[model samples]
Target: MNSDLLILDYEPAHQPAFRALNHEWIAHYFTIEPIDNEMLDDPEGYILAPGGHIFMASHGGAIVGTCALIKEHKGVYELAKMAVSPRAQGLGIGWALGQAVVAKARQLGAHRVELLSNARLRPALALYAKLGFRHVPVPPTPYQRTNVKMVLDL
Candidate 1:
């Protein structure tokens, strides 16, 4: 593989890969399913709702990572659903996808970004912090697994 990952918008054909990415990490860190097939198939419904955008990282011909940006408030965006294949971690694909999301947010005229994560995901939290995301108190949500909230000012 070239290893030069290209980040692009969600496409119907890439849903399987995206779902696999989500499932893999969810299985590792949380007991619940992160995303179901139906949700992946209906990208526009859940993933793309709230003015959100999905992105995937492709290297050679395979999708290796995925991320999403959801509109939170006026000029505020929520960065969500970031996952990299286990085989693809340590290759900077996660960072690539994150920068892509930030660039996407900039392109969309967003002023800030935020994300929800679990304390169990230390690597991901470290990566977000390295990328300038500061931790905030966790929000009260139905999802019990989430323990940290990260925010970034663009």
Candidate 2:
């Protein structure tokens, strides 16, 4: 736990790590089945596209966490795809990544930042609350898989 955790922009070579993080998070946290190839392929375009940024945290040269910011509307961004490796949890990595994304949102002059999460993700819910994200009764998502939506005013 004394190792330095480096946070930097996502790299093309780190796509597999990012994919693995996403897959594990969704499957384990959401209790959903693993993603298929098509779903896995979807992140490539976003990770490599403009108007979005990916930040990753590495410990001991291993990618332990990742977070992404994608433009949602005129003045809002979606804080999507945040995950920390199970072995690396409870180390404040998620809080650091959350602050990084909020800083990025402010840099972009975003009015608000939003994220969706499942009700069962209590740790994430607490983290979001600690970071000033207020829950909304209804979310903007069409999918019913998520029950909690929180927005941070920037």
Candidate 3:
């Protein structure tokens, strides 16, 4: 993690950055689906209101990264919407955000965390594996781009 990077809880003022960061990465590699719009457009409703959490990464006073822990069931969370600014790539921001979200999940009494992703995202997969996530069977998902599923047991 970069010495100056700070991972903080989501704030309403950070909504634009959160949306932009996620939109950038999703549009770059895959199409943004309707579910993506639902979440990105109203994270407070779909995420935070449901006992989930979102984390934001700040470096040099700019919001460079974002991640979320979406409550799925009691003791389980879905790690989603993680994105790091391309300009801030290689600064360990993604790893830092991942760690922060995992820690947050644990703090929120989560026993497990899962994520939906694509096999094509090797770097992201590597980061998730490094964060203790393991590949699992892909279940039916709303996103057509998701071909990989991972879970981290707490």
Count of residue pairs whose backbone atoms collide, per candidate: 0, 0, 0
Q: What is the RMSD, in Å, between candidate 2 and the native fold over all Cα?
A: 2.5
lDDT of 2 by residue, 94-116 (tens): 98888889998899889999988
lDDT of 2: 0.80
After superposing all C-alphas onto the true structure, candidate 1 shows an RMSD in angstroms of: 2.3
CA lDDT, every prediction?
Answer: 0.82, 0.80, 0.94
List candidate 2 segments past 4 Å from native.
Answer: 1-3, 31-40, 47-50, 140-142
lDDT of 1 by residue, 1-154 (tens): 2347788889788778877888788777776543444555566777676687999998766788999887878889988879898888888888888888898899989999999898889999999998899988887865667889999998
By summed lDDT, the worst window of 10 consecutive residues in model 1 runs over 32-41
What's the TM for model 2? 0.88
Instruction: Kindly provide the TM-score of model 1 when superposed on the true structure, using C-alpha atoms.
Output: 0.89
lDDT of 3 by residue, 83-143 (tens): 9999998999999999999999999999999999998899999999999999999999889
| Distance from true location, Cα of 74 in model 1, Å | 1.7
Q: Model 3 — which ten-residue stretch has the worst lDDT?
A: 1-10
Best by the TM-score measure: 3
Query: TM-score, each model?
Result: 0.89, 0.88, 0.98
- Candidates sorted by TM-score, best first: 3, 1, 2
